[model samples]
Target: MATEVYRESFERRTKTVRYLRFLEGLADTQVGPIYLGMWGALAFFSYLLCVFITAIGFGEQVGYNPIRFLRELPVLTLYPPPPSAGLRMAPLQEGGYWQLATLFLSLTLVFWTIRIWTRAVANGLRPMVPIAFSAALFLYAAIYIIHPIWVNSWNEAPPHGLRGILLWTNHFSVKYGNFYYNPFHMVSIFGLLGSTLILAMHGATILATLAYGAHREIDEIEKSDEGTHRAQLLWRWVMGFNATAYSIHQWALGFATLTAVAGAIGVLLSGPVEPDWFQWACRADIVSGLQKACVP
Candidate 1:
């Protein structure tokens, strides 16, 4: 009976692999992967450019400069405020800029590459567990990495840990009018959302790939055809988990979306009013980050 069951299971798995492969063949157009890959690369490079810009001011002993400020400022005003001013101003740490630049450049670049590669693999129906793990790892890095750099750049020191996180998010919310505010900062919640979208998609793709692999593996089990059924069940569960995980990032996206809608409505409802300096900076970061996220 066991042998009979095993035979049936192997036959089913063989059939499944053939089906998936057939699906791959049918979509012979290079367009999907090409476009997805291109968009991902575009988003990644743009983020890098923005990072470079952001780092330049603070990367040096003097931090937080707008390249534009130089072209427009009087020669006397060229110097950034002291570090305590919450501006990443003059007197860069010895090799601090190099270390900071290298860290961000490597982190974003590596994650970007890993994301695109895993996407390619998932698109091709290869096993993709490594890729799924990579996406999650990147998010974990963001949660840890982003806060510290931001706190340091501030004129004032951050309180500590979760306080810092709440402070940063809250600062944006009030200063920029929402959690997703990136207007003057030019690093919009939108780009972050877009990046988040990419992250979510990558996570989904990874799970799909692994499931496909597992599907093939389980089909070869020797138990009654029950094992074959279990494989199908397992595949769905993996897929479900991916969908759920990806949804987590979508909340951030949704917040950004709401801000956009509100901004648009405000524009239609009222002409622009001059906001204060803090607002302007907040807006600049949001906008700059958004544009940079698409660089190259």
Candidate 2:
């Protein structure tokens, strides 16, 4: 009996290993092309889910209605249904599905980023860039999912989760003047723009090099190493960033992550926390007050 048990365990372990290997192989080929498609599908269904709920006028707790409960299975929403789906709240549907979908997407990204980071480390390449990107997504997801739970009245009025946070931003800004006036929001905006510019710079530089070296006949460039060397030299001379190209990605990742952090801080500031950002800025007259303070 002991021998039979040991044999079964060994077989199971072998099966597990094989299964993992097979999964790894599939991850390499299948995951690359289908990732964007999956994201698009999620976004589409999430929107559709919202429309379905709003059309039917169903709020949280389908409440023994089989059709309504069945509707819940299709799309995920981040907020509870508004008091009624019209006026300011018009077109908004509340449910946990959208929030759940965002979390799921973030988790998928984190997993792939970890895989890339690990492979980079094993191959003696810098892993922190990928790891940092993953960290940003994790932080963003955490802020979205955990904010509501932290608030006491998530299920009731004064929304508190992702939806609440966004609503607060919009509500406060409209009541005051502009969300951009908030310091944290300004920082987030800058970070977002800066990340985009950096990515564009990198992409354009690479494309320029490829364009410069291309030939009318494919054989002309493919058969010789000279064209490749010319392209590299041109890129170095024009961009003057050959050595630091690798570091650019790390910087971009850091900036992108900081954008998320800034947005989270901005959300906290705009909410009904200790001090309202718009109110404080307006009452304090920070700009004029600063000038007066400097008038020594």
Candidate 3:
């Protein structure tokens, strides 16, 4: 019976499966793998560029040679060909370019999500999960783009403009000490981590019990239903309460949305408003020795 089911699933998947189409394409065609490889390389290089920009910016502050250090740190020696001088520009003067690039990318994602939502609505296929998650991320991006303009004036503008807002919120500024102590940042981190964990659990549970061969059989829906029931039973055994699939969807969406919203709140409350996050967090100290040690 298991062998029959497995053969039927394999045949059906070969004919109908779209989820692994991209992977299949890469495996089947030389051009597909080359394109995928190029895209992967581009993504890696983009990350390297960002890291380079960050290292240069911070290196200027600490009077360290960014190029020499980056090259040597991996191999444990400073003896290497020198990097280009263009990348050695003063941090304050050139670092804002990286921020501009990042800001533009964030705005692009927000606009892209908006486009997706609009297209879905036009097609009468409104997916609440995508829209909700996109809306939350849009707000997160908006915090970076709008907060600096809203908070700072021309004379006392943040040094790196919008990026300065993120830098300070992340406690890159000395005044804030550490953003980990900030309640909102902590909440955001937990939300992000929790959402990831919940997503993994849901995916694992569903995949483990899915009736792959019964997807096209209306009468065989009992197989799918039974699998889902088994998954829910497993979840109940583990969690002590079985949420319906719809309820689980809602919980996943809530976790994802909260992650972005909490992060935005953390950014909004940083820098000038809450310069010393540690101090703010330690304001109402209960333990006497700890209080005196942290306090002035």
Candidate 4:
């Protein structure tokens, strides 16, 4: 009994020491920055949430029922504050909440991105996650920041309601000519669809092979395990090639990253670069017989 007690005590001490050492290592690696960034992001996000809730309340006060607003035309929306409002807080009806929400949102994204980068670096992982996330951030900035700045009006940015954003998108497409003809928009759509297809294919393939005892590790599958072997053969027969476990992940990452990157590029190019995608398409001979309609 004494021996067993000693052994337990020693084991406990060893674990405690290891935990302390791990913490020390984390400190040495500057985990504080990660925590700091996360806290900053959380704070901003919380504030933004409050702003949204308040905006909803204001929407209700404006005689528009929150629940039924979607059913009505001219849908309830939190519009951007006028430029004349400056940085001062205005009444909720004057768009003060939206301006504050936008500011908090921008800060939240920045801090969250920093946290992602720091955490990935501390864990010795590739920066692919943060890099892919940056593309999404770029798209947001293009729509809310860059585009507004280019047009010299914050009102150019979308409002803070579902139908509001939909209306903004329709207005944007109409004012800038149909976005369907934009090459970047086409690429983005292709990437988005391709990512969805790849996700479905990979998930279905795995599930289909599971019944065949294909739950082994990738290395085991590569060694001609019966179930995984059949899977490989099935894919080879259907597509003339098969993706290994490693390669399938690469494929997923490429498609997902391309979707965001292409979307950002499309948003950035929409007004400043192309101005009118439909008109450009007509000039490029990509479409004909609609020049009169594409005059805008």
**Each candidate's lDDT (Cα)?**
0.43, 0.53, 0.56, 0.73
lDDT of 4 by residue, 1-296 (tens): 55568656766655333233566744532221124455556856766685675566456656656566545435657777686754456676677667767777777787777778887888799987888888788888988888777766677788877678899889887877888888887888888898899899888887788866676554356565566677777899999999877788788888887877787777777777888888899878787677677554
Model 1, C-alpha of 71: deviation from truth (Å)? 44
Residue lDDT tens for model 1, 1-296: 55568766766655333233455756532222133365466657756754664445343423445664454333211122234544333343422333344345546656566666667676695434444444444443333333234444432222222334456446534543433332322333354466567556544544555534423433443444443344445546866532233354455444444434433332221112432333444445545545444323
Global CA lDDT computed for model 1:
0.43
TM-scores for every candidate against the unseen true structure: 0.25, 0.48, 0.58, 0.74
C-alpha lDDT of residue 189 in model 4: 86
Q: Could you tell me which 10 consecutive residues in candidate 4 have the lowest summed lDDT? A: 25-34
Cα deviation of 291, candidate 2, in Å: 13
For every candidate structure, what is the RMSD over all alpha carbons to the true structure, in angstroms? 17.2, 12.5, 9.4, 8.8
Model 3 vs. true fold: TM: 0.58
Model 2: runs farther than 4 Å from truth? Answer: 1-78, 81-130, 155-169, 172-178, 211-243, 272-275, 283-296
Question: Please, what's the RMSD in Å of model 1?
Answer: 17.2
Clashing pairs in 2: 76-97, 76-98, 77-95, 77-97, 77-98, 80-94
Better of 2 and 4 by TM-score: 4
> lDDT order of candidates, best first?
4, 3, 2, 1
Candidate 2: TM-score? 0.48
Model 1 lowest lDDT segment of ten: 72-81
Off by more than 4 A, model 1: 1-89, 93-163, 180-296
